[model samples]
Target chain A: MNREIVLSAFDIHRSYGSADASIQVLRGADITIKIGEVVAVTGPSGSGKSTLLHALGLLERPDRGKVLICGENGWALSSRKRAELRNRKIGFVFQFHHLLEEFTLKENVMMPCLIAGESSEEASGKADRLLERVGIIHRASHFPSRVSGGEKQRAAIARAIIMKPDIVLADEPTGNLDADTSAGVEKLIMELAEEGSRSFLLATHSQDLASAVHRRFSLGSGVLREVK
Target chain B: MKQKLLWALARRHVWSDANSTVVRMVSALSIAGVAIGVAALVILQAFMGGFTEAVATGLTAMNPPLHIYLPGGGHMDDFDLGAVQSIASEIPGITRVEGVLEKPAVVSGAPGTVSGAMVRGGNNAGLTIGMDLARELGVTAGDEIRIASTAGVEISGMGRVLVDTIVALAVDSVADFGLEEYNSSLVILPLNTARDIFRAHGELTSLGAFVEKGTDPVEASELLNSALYREYAGGGWPVYMSCIPFLAFHGNLFKALGLERAAMTIVLALITVVALLNLSSALTMIAMEHRRDIGVMRAMGLPPSGVFRISILRGFLLGGSGAVTGLAFSWISIFTINRYFPIKLDGTVYWIDVLPGVFPVTTALVVTLLTILVCLAVSTFPAFSALSRSPSEALRYE
Candidate 1:
């Protein structure tokens, strides 16, 4: 299958606030992921798990680091190029599901494809397939507000992979759901990862979710340590 | 395709029920504000334009489109009426040319009714008195009135003697010139009668020239002046004359109307500015309320420029809707007022019996475009403010 490394972050450093009174979040975080791999990043509260994900996802710039998506240096690219790279190569699923309330589940799933300049008919067709694959095809026409928590998360997952990105960065994807719903979402994630088409980088405090992935890392003191 | 997505995002954000009630209400108020401001400016311009047009029409009704007089307002003695007519006839758009003499006289009807009036002498026979003069003299059409002219006065060896000339004429018509001064004092008579009564034979005050419809009287006057100068110069006569257009003769009244329109435009433009300020506030509020959604969209890989474009598009939608609505409302209001409920005015004061309301299409278009520009300009600050916050910062709490 020629599973090549699709994403790599080297010695990332990020912080908040001014230099005089700053809160350093990610001091020197590093990670690498290959295609068709499911990796988990585990950390306690106040750890830099989400910060690392944000840095790698291109949503936030690191003070000192290199985020390589598909082996391209994202930080060195212009903001526009970086945005295009993010739209085409990386997708995100936040803890809150974060489905746009104004759009139907199908529309939310089609957004990344649309942003990537795909035709609506093509995007719509892909979205429907993804929705059915995620087992939320019945709720595809319902808005985010009208869908259940599990269904919204399923839609978010469907949306993250709509553009066939190299990696999906999930930050506590099931953090806001109940145990059964979380388990169901977790099962859905594992099943999608089993298809071996794209990689998954999941950041969660749940041990069960952390243990279910192919590889696992523990983040503390703004550093990552391989545990699996 | 990206532009289509951005547009879709903007449209959905603006019309989404997910927005807070406060945001929706503020948006509605902003739109209403713009509509009202545009409507006020348009209606005011329409009425002012109509009023100016009405006044100009009234003034031109009583005065000739062009008048030729001797330099320094002197009466012409032994004037060549045929030569002037021939010169005027050669010029295109000069419909007619006629010599006229006017003098002040006292008009009396019945035993005690007497009024001082200016007697205008033209080629037309019979006496046509002004409405106010006829009222003062207790005369109407078919009534006999005596006009006594004091233009023939002499100084004798003993003392100054007044050779008063009185003539009786039947009132032909009572004319309302829509002007207070003209209606209250003018008296029209035949040229022969006026010359005999004023003892000014073979003398004419001025030559009035009427122009064709849609012809610029100023241009016609200039042509006439040039023609007359060339004619007199060719004859080796050093005669000077002045040709005055209707607008130049009544420049003050028209200038006052123009000044009023300018002043009113400035005042009313302030209303539009205030309305746009409200729009700025509303857009700012919307930005604040939608901060989380903006974060989500950004996280979804929407560029900062795309976000800015969406914000601008929202402003265009809101402001464009308001401007169009205001234009339609103004047009309907003007049509209704002009067609069904025309406002009546005092003829003596306003010079027209009914106040006019005209829809000025060009002015409306200008107002709409300016409003949309202001809307976009105001939206810039909020759009920039929205872009100031990082996507992570906005989504931190969520």
Candidate 2:
């Protein structure tokens, strides 16, 4: 069967450190996720899982590669234009649930819309709706520190989807959660992928969570292979 | 629009977290430093300005505002006194004009009563000696004094020939003029008496014009020149007359004072620079503490310029509040100093009874702008340092 591709990478290579003492993170990694697809990449520690997620999220430039969002080459865009695209078209969830401590959960969720130049009133309404959908509306006014780890992750997921981006990238989204919280977050991610008509790309070490996605890839030794 | 978002975040960072002791302490100390710097600068400047103004006032009082005379001491013979007085009166800021006939003479009291002193006769009817001069000569009011003028007397081997123009006049009350040299050895007599002693009839020495208070001397001189051209230069009087402002008559004294005032202001402004340095250190601390948050902000699509602007706005807010507080301090202190704590100075030395203060709006405005600019400059290093590394690196770490 055929599906519309929302995000794809072709022959991406990334490395760290100077040439004499370099560590190759991704020799040549390629990925594709269709609309409404929940794809997961399972990898062990030091397997370049987070690096691949960062390159896909446009947080860092892959040394030699092409990243296309909705068939548009991201490398061709200027830095400022790339920032704008990230603000409007891409969302991210980190392992630490990087919610700004200065703002409440609702404000943190509304940040994407604010960055997109939406009015505060409009952003507030959208934030409230997303919080309600994620079952964290009760703690909307509470700060990140005041919430539990599971609740903070839920808020992070809400913030990621508030913009209704074409793709959502999660780098070890459940790495810091317990079994029950991780299971709950996994269910939320799949449900949002269906309801929001967006692709979700998750990198994690949990076999159960990886099995829940429509497709699973194992990353190790600087290569990606289907997990059957 | 992006800038608005960043501005909102900056505002949140500035105002939120009241419970954090570190943030509260840093902000309070920064504001206090700026406030104290501003207050010290303004007060020192006002005191310096007041001292200079007081000295200028005293010097101008001793001499009239405008002294009109010809170059090379050319005597005025049968000049147009009416035209001159009318022209001077027509000028703006001109208050009074007087025709003065000056002559040098020797004045001595009764033998064994007082020694002789150098005298220059003034417009007063009788002989009026300065208080200090009277004390030196051991004379008081109602005393007889003899004055002599040696216009053409020949000195012989036997003795100097007295031209016999000696006139005795009763002493009037002694006056105190603020200058030491003038008060010590100078005496005044009627202008007509001076003319008689000098054997000059119907010849005036110079014209003196006094101006209103708070008038700019340069502007007053220009007005005098305009009046002269309009009135006297047509069928012109006997010779050329130069209108010299009293302050210009002793230019070097006030020039030195002006230079000193500028130097002191520059030195006092260094205090504000120290305050700015304090603010910069506090901002650097803030940046270090918020490193993770800044990384998150950059990941949230805040452009580099947006990040840079947030830091600049932070400095502006901090320095702006401090400058206003400082101006308030200056305003209240000036009022209190002028009202309650009047600083007295030695009248003989400073020529004023109490220290004065003037708060010009320009000084406050210029200082406010300068402080904000300084804060911006000092904050640049730390603000840019927040984004010096890759945002991805910041996210990868903590």
Per-residue CA lDDT of model 2 for B257-336, tens digit only, reads 77987887887788788888889987777666666677676666767777778787778777877888998899899889
DockQ of each: 0.56, 0.39
- Candidate 1 — which pairs collide? none
lDDT of 2 at B280: 90
TM-score of the candidate numbered 2? 0.78
For model 1, the stretches where C-alpha displacement exceeds 4 angstroms are: A1-3, B71-74, B77-95, B103-201, B212-215, B219-240, B387-389
List interface RMSDs for the candidates, in order: 1.6, 2.0
Q: Over the true interface residues, superposed, what is the Cα RMSD of model 2? A: 2.0
Clashing pairs in 2: B121-B189, B122-B189
Clashes counted in candidate 2 amount to 2
lDDT of 1 by residue, B1-398 (tens): 37888878776766677656776778788888899999999999999999888778777887788988877767875456667888899999999988888878888987799888898888777889888878888889999999898777778997888886888889999998777678888998888888988888988988889999999999999899899889888799875877889668769878988899999999889988898888888887777766777777777778889878888988887788778888999999999999999999887678677889989989999999999998988888878887887777767744
